[model samples]
Target: MMQQHGQHGQRDGVDAAELAAELAAELPADPVVPRVEAASVAVNLLWCVPGDVGGSEEYLVRQLLGLGEQASDFVPTLYVVKSFIETHPALAKLYPIEVANLTGVDRRRRVVAEHTWLRRRTQHAELVHHGGGTTPAVGTRPIVLTIHDLQYLTHPGYHSKLKLQYLRRTMPRSVHRASVIATPTDWVRRTVIEEFDVAPDRVVVVPHGVEADIGVEAPSEFELRSVYGLGSGRVIVFPAITHPHKGHEFLLDVMAQHWDDPDLRLVLLGGKGLADQRVAAKIAELHLERRVIRPGRVPSSHRDGLLQLAHAMVFPSEYEGFGAPVVEAMSLDTPVIAADQPAVSEVIGDAGLVLPRDPEAWADALDIVADQRVELIAAGRRRVTEFTAAKSGAALAEAYRLALS
Candidate 1:
C-alpha cells in the first residue's frame, strides 16, 4: 500500500511539472506593456462681430463657412460672441461653437472681453485663428491673424479719430504677437510686412474666393422700375458702402458730367457708412437726384440681378485689401471699371479696365469698356476661374498646416 501511494504521488508531481513548463513557455519574456495613442489637436477660430458689419466681416464669415466644409487633420472650433450666434443660429449647427456671452458695448469693453476669453478658454487649443483682423495682445496659443488691410493707418482721414487711435495702438502689437499673418492680396502682404516690420515669411497672401454659383440673370425692366423706381436706361452699378475712401464722390462727379444723358442711370447698392451724410450732401450739391438711385443693401439675388442687367460695374475705391466686387463682377461676366490701386490692379489683371481715380479717366474708361464689352466680358469670365473657393480653401488649408508645424 505504501509503494502504490508513492507511485501515485510521483505521477501527480510529473503532471504538475509539465503544467508549469507549458505556462512558462506561453508567457512573454518581459512585463506586459500598454499601447499609447497621441491626443488629437484642435484649432480654434475667433470670429466675433455684429451682424451688420460690412464687407470685411462678411469675408471672414464666408471663410469660416468654407473652412467648416473642408476636411482638416485637426478638429476646428469656432468661438463666436453671443450676439453673433443669436443673429446666426445656423452657425451653432454648422460647426462646434463655444459661445462667449460678451457685451460689446464699446471698443474698450469688447477688447477686454476678447482678451479675457482667449486667456481662459483657449488652453486646449493648439492654434488660434483671429478672423476679425485683430488678435489678443496676451495669449500663449500660436495665432494666425488675418489683417485685411492697413487702411486705417494709410487713410486715417476715412476713419474716426477714436478708431484711428485704437488701430494705431493695437495693430502693431497684434502684428508682432501673431505667429503668422494672412492678407487678401500680395499688395496687402507686402504692405503688412513693410508697415508692421514683420518678417516676409511670416505673412501669407490668400486671395478671396469667388462663389462658384455667382452668375448673372437679367431682371425684368418692369420689375426693376416697380421695385427700385428705375426706368429702362443703361444702368451703371456701384456696389460699395458710402465710405470716404470708396471714391463715391469721384463716381458722382463722373455721373454729374453725364447727368444730361437721358438714357443713363447710376445705381448704388450698399449700407450707409460714416460718410453717408457727406455723400448725400454731395449728391444734393451736384443735383444728381434724378440720375442716381440708392437701393441700400439689396439681397444677393437682387444684387446679382442688378449686376446682370447693368452696363458696367464702376469700382473706384482708393484703397482695398481685396476687391470683392471686382471679382464678383468678373465672375458674372460683367465689365468692371476699377481704380488703379495696387490690390485692384492685381485683381483686375487684364480682365477689366484699371484707370486713375480722376473722373475724366474713369469716364473715358467707361466709354472704352462700353465699346469693347464682348472681349472684356470673355476675359473677366476666364480670369474668375483663378479665384474659386476650392483654390482658396486649399491654400488656406496649407497655411493652417504650416502654422501648426
Candidate 2:
C-alpha cells in the first residue's frame, strides 16, 4: 500500500512540472530594449544681450535653429536670459529654454550665475557649449567653447577698461578648460590657437552660415523707401551698426568723395554703437547728412528690401571673425564690395570685389558695380549656397561629438 501511494505522488509532481513548462511556452519572452546613445548638450547663452551682440547674436541663434532642424545626434537645451526669450520668441518655442532669473545686460550678475546657478543646473548634461567665448570659473561638464573672435585682445581699444580686464582674466583660463574651441573662420581659429597656446587640433573652424530664405519676406522697395524717408537715389547699403571698427567714418568719407554724384546715397543700416557720437561727428564733419542715412536699426524686411533695391552692398569693417554680411548681401543677390581683411577675403573668394580700406579704393569699386553687376550676382549666388545652415549645423554637431570623444 505504501509503494502504491509513493508512485501516485511522483506522478502528481510530474504533472505539475509539465503544466509549468506549458505556461512558460505560452508566455512572451522578455522584450529587448534599445539603448539610447544621444548625449545632452546645454548651450550657455547667459551672456547674450538682445540687440546688443549684433552679428554674434544672429550667428548663435541661426546655428542653434540649424542644429534643431538638421542634427539629431544630441539633444540641445538653451540656457538664456529673459531678453533672449522676448526677442526670440519663435526660437524659445523650439528648445527647452531655462531662463536665468537675472538680466544679461549686467556682466557681474551673469558671471556669478554662470559660476553658481548654471553649474548646478547643468550637472546632468554631458557637454556645455559656451556661446559667450568664456567658460565659468567652475565648469560641471566638458566645454565646447565658441570663441567668436579674440577681438578684446586684438583690438583692446575697442572695449572698455573693465571689459578688457574681465576678458584678460577669463579668456586664457576658458581656453585651457575647453575640450574644443569653435571658430567661425580659419583666421579666428588660427588666432585663437596662437593666442591661447592650445593645440591646433583643439580649435575647429565651423564656418558661419546664412539662412536659405534670407530676404524672402522682404517688404516692397516702395514701402521701404517711404518708411525710411529715403529718396530716389541709387542706394549703397552698409548693413552694420555705427561702430569705430565698422569703418563708418571711412565709408562716410568715401561717400564724400562721390559727392559729385548728387543722386547717390549711402544707408548706414543698424543700431547705435559705442562709436555713435564719433560717427555722428564724422558725418557732420564730412557734411554727408544729405547723402547718408542712419536708420538706427530697421526691421528685417526693411533691411532686406533695402538690400534688394541697393545698387551694391559695401562691407568696410576693419575686423571680422567671419564676414557674415558679405554672404548676406550675396544671398540677397546684391553685389558685394568688401574690405580685404583675411576673413572677408576668405568669404569673398573671388565672388565679389575685395579692396583696401582706403576711401579712394572703395569709391573706385563702387564705380565698377554696374559693369560687373551680373557676374558678381551670379558668383555670389553660387558662393552663398555653399554656406547653408545645414552645413553649419552638421559642422557644429561634429564639433560637439569631438568634444565628447
Candidate 3:
C-alpha cells in the first residue's frame, strides 16, 4: 500500500501498503521471514512513570513490549513504575495492572528520604524518585526513558510539592542516561531540549497510538445510556478525573454557566484526585447534579460505548504530552472539542474546535462543535488514524537501532 507524505517529505499517512501485503502473501507460500530476523547484543529498560497510571503510559508500554513479537531484528526490555510508589502508599494502587512493567528502586543511601509525605525510591530511584522503587529492573536490555510530560515544571498546579521535587531531580538523569529518550509529542521534545539542554537528535518523539482495534468490548449507545441510567440530551464526555491540569474546574464552570440548556449532559470517566473535591462541590453549588454523570472510569469494554453515545468530546486540559483519550474518541468517529494550545493543536491538527481556555469561550465552542458533528468526526478519524502501534513501534525500533548501533 501507499502512504501520504507531507511537505516536509515525511510519511504523514498510510496508504494500502500493497508491497507489505505482497510479502505477507508470500509468507504462506514460502518461509522467508523467520531466518531473516536479527537479534540485539546489549540492552536495559527503565519505564518512567509519567502520570498516575493510565491510558498513554499503558498504550505506549504495550506497544514497546509488543516489539519483541513484531520485530525479530531486536530484543527490547521495559521498566514501568512511577517514582513515588514507595513513599506514597495510596498511589501504588494506581499503577497500571494491565501491562507488564517494572519500576526503579530509589536508593537514597539513607532512610530519611523514604518517609511518607517525603516519598523515597532508590538514589537513582530515591533522590530522583523523591524516594521509592516499586520494583527493580527485570532485564538488562538497553534502557529507554519515556518522559510523558514535563508538566510539574511548566504546570505545577497539576501535582504536589513532593511530586514536583522528584521530577526536577530525577527526570533529567533519566533523559541523559537513557540509551534512547522517548517522548509522546514534539512539544515534550522541545521541553526536554530547553529544560535539560539535551540535543534534539538524541530525543525521539513517538506519540501514543490508539488501541481501538485491540478488540475492546465496548457497548452500544443504547447500552451506554441504559448502563449509565441516562436519556439522551446531548452527551459530552471528558475522559479525565478531577485534576487541575485536566481543567475539570473549568469544565464545571462552562457547563454550570449554561445550566439552562436542557440539551446537554456532561460525563466524567475517572475518579477525582485530592484537588477535584472543590470542583465537585462547585457542581453541587450549581445544582447540576442530574445534568452531570460521574460514572467513574469507563472500562476498556465501554470506552467505545461511551464515545459512541457522545455528541462531542471536550478535552480542555491545561497541558498534555499527547492526549490519548482525544485520539481514541476520534478513532471511534466521535466529534471532539479539544484545547487550543500548541501541543494539543499540533495533535488535533485541523480536526476539532480548538478554543481558548476560558469557560465561557469553551461553552460557546462546545455548542458549535455539537452542531458541526460531521466535520469534527471526520477530522478526528483522520488525525487519530496516523498513530498506530505498528507505526510508533516500528519508528521506535529504528531509534533503538541507532542507539545501540
lDDT of 3 by residue, 202-275 (tens): 77876777553743577777878888866867788888756667788788888877535775778888755555
Candidate 1 C-alpha error for residue 335, in Å:
0.6
* Order of quality (TM-score): 2, 1, 3
Q: All candidates' lDDT scores?
A: 0.69, 0.78, 0.56
Query: Per-candidate TM vs. native?
Result: 0.84, 0.88, 0.72
- Superposed model 3: Cα runs more than 4 Å off: 1-51, 65-69, 77-142, 212-216
By how many angstroms RMSD does model 3 differ from the true structure? Answer: 14.7
**Model 3 per-residue lDDT at 95:** 29
In what order do the candidates fall by lDDT, top score first?
2, 1, 3
Inter-residue clash pairs, candidate 2: none
RMSD of 2: 19.7
Enumerate residue pairs that collide in model 1.
none
Q: Residue 63 of candidate 2: its Cα lDDT?
A: 83
How far does residue 227 in candidate 1 sit from its true spot (Å)? Answer: 0.9
Better of 2 and 3 by TM-score: 2
